[model samples]
Target chain A: ELGPMIVTAAIGQDTSLEDGDILVVTQKVISKAEGRIVDLRTVTPSERGLKLSIETERDPRLVELILRESKSLIKIDSERGIIIAETHHGFICANAGIDQSNVAGEHMVSLLPEDPDGSARRIREEVAQILGVRVAVIISDTFGRAWREGQVNFAIGVSGIDPILDYRGSLDKQGSVLKTTSIAIADELVAAGEMVMGKAEGIPVALIRGYRYQPSAGGVAYLLRDPASDLFR
Target chain B: ELGPMIVTAAIGQDTSLEDGDILVVTQKVISKAEGRIVDLRTVTPSERGLKLSIETERDPRLVELILRESKSLIKIDSERGIIIAETHHGFICANAGIDQSNVAGEHMVSLLPEDPDGSARRIREEVAQILGVRVAVIISDTFGRAWREGQVNFAIGVSGIDPILDYRGSLDKQGSVLKTTSIAIADELVAAGEMVMGKAEGIPVALIRGYRYQPSAGGVAYLLRDPASDLFR
Candidate 1:
């Protein structure tokens, strides 16, 4: 059986974290605290924007923000209401990570926090100073996958944890050339935490215990693929 | 820190699974136990197969098996060495879920177990009967994602866990409706377990504890997406 649950809040201030403790803060809470919400009513849509809305099968206002956030539009399928774009951070995700859920009002949506790695670093520093123990911070959001059944939460920003486990040079039991490298450990952890922190439960945080992950100097940025090296594009 | 490690192997037999205990048997173990491995030397590559591989940039021998396994070929990318086909079980994955890794010797790979869900169910039932506790069994493999950085593991077969968590009809804190909802928790779990078990670590299975997951009556088959409803395809 799992241990008892501990609930806490940011309370407009930083809270310390401990080892084996998983911080499961909601993206909405982080955006609200960081002032990342954008008012949709204040923005104006263009003719190109209206065309994109019809092309993407999304709201015109939402498509306008998505277009602005996008550095490159990879694909747009009007029938499926799907638009894959490269974000400013070089992350290729749907809608450029612009989201309508969990905003304070109807006419507003929140963009992913600018420099999530930076946010995670700041939180880690604050928590370490207060609690005198190390902890890993994962900022998560829901994302769709290609050729999969449903959406799953994944880590957008992470600190104090190695995001990818590279096994390129390692050998399997049979000693054959094992090129199965780069496992996304951090993203999976965020998805696991989302199981307990339900979408509608108002529980923005979850504490994870019993597993110890290996520490690495490499940060979450390593998980971001360089577009030049990407063969699919 | 995590608890002590545990591992189990079914040497000539496919046994049932138990709670908190992981079966470390290889895909070859299960395939051999189920008699699914095909001896390529026994078969001949057809004239049409040779012509198609020249066009598809696929190994003729492998393509022959893939065509046999696939109900239909959805898409083919010769440049990227990818072929998306619908498997007999109606799964649309790369190469019809035929893998070329971790097999017995050179020039041999394994087809996905004939009945993955049934295999998982049988293993779960037998393991429970032996150890007297419920356990989740996942048959995993590495698959590349379209428009993503690196390959991640996904559950090709699963038991004793709900592959997708449906949150439809649920309301957010602000009373907003959640439409088009479900979380693919089991696939995420399989991916997470791969992080620790790893391809080269000789840890084919890792016992996970301290995480509580609710099972669904539909089991892992519920996670399979219908081709008509798949937006990305």
Candidate 2:
């Protein structure tokens, strides 16, 4: 009850969440709640998808979902067979953060929660009403980076918080013009929480303490950078 | 001697080295060491640069570097221009992690260390000799993401450690296949260290404790993803 179970219970209980409380819910729980399970057997791979499977070396159904979710195809590596893509969320993560792990049955996959931010907002509003206090909710998933090693958890969906803190026009110690822009505070928090919520552990959720954050109108969408403005794009 | 010293003697003393440690040196220190200062009086803007400046509303020298480093020109706003390019290190980031901040005088700009991985390796070797222990080094920089808010610190150069940990054939608790490919532990560590080394605090180097990492033959250059194999190129 001290880990994921406690987190699950806390979500259901009526209580007030405070300013610094962090509700760490696992992607699996969110996926389960939203009924995002995709049965691989039910998915009939199209001829085009079969050809893509031969080309990309990925499960046909998963490849189909990835193709459907992608805004634009970036590349297809034959060796790894990874179809790197820009998901609907404008994130250029591998496989669009799709997964075939931790499903209840054979040949089952889980899509990322549809409208994750909306789901987070709904949960935050409902929990606030029950507990009579404000709180921040973050839905996390594992992601790979372009030129770095190892996967770390990141916040795919967030609510009741400003994920990025803009510090433009501030002053540095040397009386210099401070143009250091946004700080991805929410993503850092998610990564920090992942340290305790290890991949091998069944602890899918954790409650973060001690860190303080302020509410803003921007919410999580502010964390999504427009590709047009991205120099790395 | 532990909390915030203000003199040159207080920085990089013989006694300040340790085993299995990663030293994160700021660009300011590297610029000061290498004497790569651009005095405004000596800077003669090219006519083309000046005309581009007028159109873009930015410093001509800065824009010149941006243009030279870019592989493909993306967009140009009034004060900001975006370009996608592979850095000299083969990693892709904005403006190649160049900056106009924290310079000693007006119109002075600092380039990234001539060879960041070399600098890191040199520091690691020096510190290891001094302390008689194995150590790792990572030269970090703040960079903007393609589709994310806020800049998180990432490893521009690394040595003595593996940047990515591959977990392709691992198993989950439920006897499921874990295709969790790679994890960017080093970059994540850098981001976590930024929490302690605030941009304004003048504390560029932080000593991270408790976490343990393995040694590998592959150095920091291995962290750079090949654009051909990269999914997000």
Candidate 3:
């Protein structure tokens, strides 16, 4: 649905995805296309969800959905009314990346796509087949940081691009060996793409051209920090 | 120094900073302009610096500078050789944001700008006077996240633009009342700007055009989180 729909939207708007273009798409539209929208009115809270809802002061049914989506909870600060959970996809985010905003109605909440990397690959293949142009796709979602205030969009899915620009062992302009300078390129590009996407205005996609990224099958999994090295965890 | 040099460089390159354009300048160049660069050979390690250096397996002279620049140590994982400290500017980063990359030589390291927000304002003012065009300026630095791998550029200094966009209390298109959806726009824009900047190539500045950010005097201080609310600390 996403690959065809995105192509249709582009053609309808008199634009085309050029060769070597990176299409940054929001995760909301991808989830919607995958029928991940859930109605809170139809949900019932489990015992643990009910207790957590009371502690966090959230809707019991919504908490149930979040519990279902998460593989483990990292931080449960009842005082701050926050639950930082490791989602099924190994992403640690608040409320398991579930949100009611940008959905159709108040009772509607969307879950993250079942397989975000696969979702991106399918879109890339279909787009290439239809237009005969090679392009990369990224699925982005806004997530809060640990010490930083507010949220910025991060790459949750990727296809046809190496996620990180590994600059370790590379030489700088001054002939100094760069150490530990691998940049999270997919995350940066997604955050860049989010600037053009009007969040409040419901613009879910942005076209980023002219950036020459290393093509690789190594998906967003590369962006997730190894738990052993992560000090905060 | 940054203001004049940046303007001169723009003229040299025959590029003009247009109105509503956000200029993203990396912190390294600003520090270099401000004489924040230090030769590791010139520093004398203190008693505490020597002890910490051995534990963290870092250069004693470099550790001495990091200790002096930091207000407090947040995390010290000797096993990982990672020291997360709160910089004087209130940024929590490794080695208090001291970096040897992008500088003249391996012996030299760049400290973060003393007053990042003021540095941004100076660039904005000088660009306005030279080109008669108003522009927002952001001083950016690459930082590692707690749960994520690699680093994305963040706004450590901001001028002529509000660092955040608060969408709380606004009605969505579905007529639902949104809550707690403030975005760190300055950080996102910096990451976007980093895409064009060749890190290994030593390109320190990037220009972003056509983003309608709200102009404000609220500096990057707004991006720092209150320690009381931060769960990681």
Candidate 4:
């Protein structure tokens, strides 16, 4: 499996990533390395899957796979072929992140890693052991946003850096208490990396240097909102 | 009023931006230069504004301004004092992009420009005229997303770049057609810029180079989804 060495090789040895540097890794490579691939042909449609398949006009096998991967169905637009769902890992995306693009075979589709936060932690530790440099790691995935037209990369998992920059008690330039001003740095970094690691391009890893962030031991779980607090959902 | 000259002065004369360079500018500066500031003291609360103010537990004057600026109210969490609104320009943001921070006085607040796309166009034209260089411009603002915790910067306005890199008919590495793989480069670029442009940091502008994007004559309006097509509002 490709690791930090892959990043070093791509960026060249001349450029060394220092402490506080963040590494944004796309889900494609991580999924491939983790063997999260599923064979669509192997899936058998359940009763629910059969009903959903008829309504959505999709393959029963694919529908079965979606049901297996998802914890709950968030939104389903049968006419438009859109099925937004929350995966078992609490990730909300189309088809439960059952990706069909860039796979080895037509019948193969990639699923998100079982524990992306654990995946991120392992990568961060492995890279640190190899390079002797402490760095934050972020696993990114492209997901469509509500009320917004296009899809943007978000942090499906994070390690080392504080996922949220809380400015609750901080005073603004006007000397007012900054409430409701926590910044999602992980998602922002992922989006930044997407600028370099294009969708069609083979580059799945990006190193961000010169930016400062608070280092902490946490995962992307903290980035998710509680259902009670989430009014839009 | 800060333009390309300011960027050159900061980065130095030895450096030069090449073709395919994208400029990510924060909406704060654009709003300030365009005189989008509103004095809370001068705003008179309308009947609807007064009722919404009491419900949201916010200042009546501010609510009045918000009501005047917004085309529709999306969500109102009265207990949380959060009001989600869609501005007249079709931007969905907190209080219609009204900000109390980074301003000169406590009474002074800034609203989003009447036409952010137009503002981006003007800034792009001005910078191009000054430097005689072609560059895509994106105006960004911090926005809270539904189902996600914390806020990330989004492209409220854009010019020159194609905004979306659609890969519907493109063939993947596996020789399969990429059906649903449009990348939102504008929003991603904006989020990337947020890394360099910290919330408290005064660096409102960021220069992104080396990435190639299709040049186009369009605004951010094209990036918006039609209400008929949008299942999530």
Candidate 5:
């Protein structure tokens, strides 16, 4: 598992882990450690996957995997060769969070971890046993936004941390009530950690210290908005 | 201006500024420092402002300021009391980034800086002259996401840094080329910096050191998606 590996690497790098520190791990490493790899050559496409493959110009086998991982299809931009899908985990991303990059071979792709929050908990437990320090664990993945051109890393799973720093009843500097001012701090923490864990560099973990984050057992599911309330979805 | 104030606070905290360091400042403090404030009693609502105020259940004067700052309106969720608009700077946020909180008085509202990029450049110059060190400046504001439930601090102004870390031609761990994997490092940096700059606590500045960034004169315009190409606008 990547949990003990992360502890070894932290000691190797001379990083002294402390209580309340955050450990942000990329979803790729967790997926790889869990054997969520698929060999495209060994897979067969379904009828719907073949039709979608023709439209998205993607491999039929890869499309089949995407179909299996997705709960529903959100958009099919055939002109752009992109398929926006909602994963079974309620994540809206391109190709159901399945990607061909950063894997073992050209014909292999990695699927997201089946239980991300559970993965976070297991890793947190492993690190606590080895490192002798309690730290928050966040599993993050990169995703595209609605009106933004570039993508930012967001939390898919969280453990030992509250997802949001709510300020609904907090008063501002002027003594005025802040009605809707909760900060999605878990998402921000992952985005910050992504800077150190750059793509194509194989750096899967980032440590954030000195930021006092609220501790909780809240998972990343708190960040997802319901489609009935989300206007864009 | 907030430039000298930030340097003073850093000195008080015994932090030394270094080259390649990033300074993320909140927009609320910059607006308050720049005198970009208005009294609600001084504003006279127009015909369109009154019409929108009735539907949105907002003050007509506040609606007038939102309309003046917005270049175009995208969505008006009357039931939610939200005015999703494309600001003159092309940022699609609620109420054109105007807010009544964080000001000095109950009837005062703060408007976003007229030129955020210029504000960043000015602050960058101010810090260089005082501290005798080069630092990248990013002005951040809390913005609500379209699909997410809470808000995150995003860079609205940037100077002395390239907004994106382009990894298009870079090869991944599997030796496969990453076609579309540019990281929005500026936005990610601000998201990290926001951890120190908590909302309603009056901590409007954050210092991030030891991060190596490619220097450029690129502005925050690089982050905005063109409406023509955006799928969900």
Candidate 6:
């Protein structure tokens, strides 16, 4: 029961999950379903974790979990209480996407799913089986960007559609060769989904209807740039 | 009109631009209206600009414009032909947010407004005056993230509302104290606006109604992070 569940049957009957629709599932649900929860009572903080905990003024157990989930520590801003870490899954996020909010117990926290793309694909397949419809799936997570303040929902995982709608080499309205116009449709949809699945609201899954997208095989793997190509890291 | 016109009147009458509404304006229209368009023919490439042009395999004239608009060049990926620059307004974007597509002429490229927050405030004031209603205005631009591929619309400027809805110290569904949950409402709204204003569809302005937000004094300047606080740059 802790693993991923096929939630198509549980969704409201009035809502029609149809073809050409996008099913935006929040990462919180996926993490819960995947049993990615960690109990603070069980965590044994390492020396490094304890050091960081003291530096960050956070719980040593929480710091241990963050260290376990993170591949590399990018930055530690104790004044701001923000730790930029590269998660084991290669995501650059605050605290390695280990979140303390919305869990059942106060002592427990949820980690991002290990393979979010795989998780998305499985969910998409299960939903397709139940509904007999082709729909894109996006695993959405809230993340803060480098230069911008505040956090917005981003597509941590994607399935059934290409995340990017590449308009490069395409003709603009004036027939100009378009460049630098590849739209992150998944991320945009994630942001749109957040409008419906509010932070305080319990709506974990949102149906984005009427929007059409090109079918694709891969998930959010292509969204990750090579280390050589990334200037920020 | 070579500058951004308060376009509330031009928007279709069918769409009621009402109070508590968010008007998302694409930066393309704002830049065009603000006369931020630069003629490539007129640019005289400096020695550094010319060197960067050859290294980045771009037009020297365009490189000069990029240098002029940028406060600092963050990173230059010569192999991939990408220049990550901190714009004069402190936005980290490719080519310093100088866009080539969707402009009137092939020889012309649009520059990000010197004061996008100022531009948004003026537009908001003008729109409020015309409609006799208060509304939030967001100046949106598409930007590629440091780790992720493709581009999603971001709030380059905002007016009439605080861009962030901070949920820190608030109770979650499970009564847990939520921290690190500040939502970037403006950027999320920008993404929603993109859903309505499709690229190449020529729709530049989108009116979002029914969503309530807190009225605030400042623009998107608050969204810009201090360089010392930023780890990615």
True contacts kept of each: 0.54, 0.59, 0.83, 0.71, 0.87, 0.81
Question: Which 10-residue window of candidate 2 chain A scores lowest in summed lDDT?
Answer: A1-10
Better of 2 and 3 by TM-score: 3
User: Which digits, one per residue and each the tens of the lDDT, describe model 2 over residues A127-229?
Assistant: 6665566678787788776555467767788887778756677655566777765678777777766646667555676666656666754555677777766
lDDT by residue for model 3 over B1-233, one digit each (tens)? 67777778877898867899889999988998999999999999999999999999989999999999999999999986889999998999999999999789668999999999999999999998888999999999989998889888989999999998888889776777778788999999999887788678888788888778999988998899998898888
Q: What is the DockQ of each candidate?
A: 0.44, 0.42, 0.82, 0.69, 0.80, 0.72
Instruction: State the lDDT of candidate 4 residue by residue for A1-233, as single tens digits.
Output: 55566656745856676778888888988899999898988888999999999999988888888999999999999997788998887888888998888888989989888888888888788777787778888999999988777889989999898999988778765677776789998999998888678776667788888888888887898788887988766
Candidate with maximal lDDT: 3
TM-score per candidate, chains pooled: 0.81, 0.80, 0.98, 0.95, 0.96, 0.92
Using DockQ as the measure, what is the rank order of every candidate, best first?
A: 3, 5, 6, 4, 1, 2
Which of 4 and 6 is ahead in TM-score? 4
Ranked by DockQ, the better of candidates 2 and 3 is 3
Native contact share for candidate 6: 0.81
Residue B211 miss distance in model 1 (angstroms): 5.1
lDDT of 5 by residue, B1-233 (tens): 77787788888888967788899988888898788899989999999999999999999999999999999998888998889998999998989999877888888888998888889999888889998889999999889987687899888999998888888999997789998888788889999987877888888888888888889988999899888778886
State how far residue A74 of model 5 sits from its true place (Å).
1.7
| Interface RMSD of every predicted model, in angstroms | 2.8, 2.6, 1.0, 1.4, 1.1, 1.3
lDDT of 4 at B103: 73
At residue A222, candidate 4 shows an lDDT of 79
lDDT of 1 by residue, A1-233 (tens): 00111222432334434575656555666766688788988777788789999876788888988888888987777888988887786667778888766565788788877877776666666666665667777777787776678887777777777777666777666777766456677776776677578777767665556557666555556767676655345
**Candidate 5 structure lDDT:** 0.89
**Candidate 5: where is the Cα deviation over 4 Å?**
none
lDDT of 2 by residue, B1-233 (tens): 11123112324464454566655666566555667555656656777658766787767777666555445543355556443446666656665556666676666776677677776677666665554666776777777665676877777767787777565677676777676656676776777666566666566775655556667756666666665555555
Residue-wise C-alpha lDDT for candidate 6, range B92-209, written one tens digit per residue: 8889999888898879999998787777788777767777777788899989888888888999988888898888888888987776688988889899888778777767888878
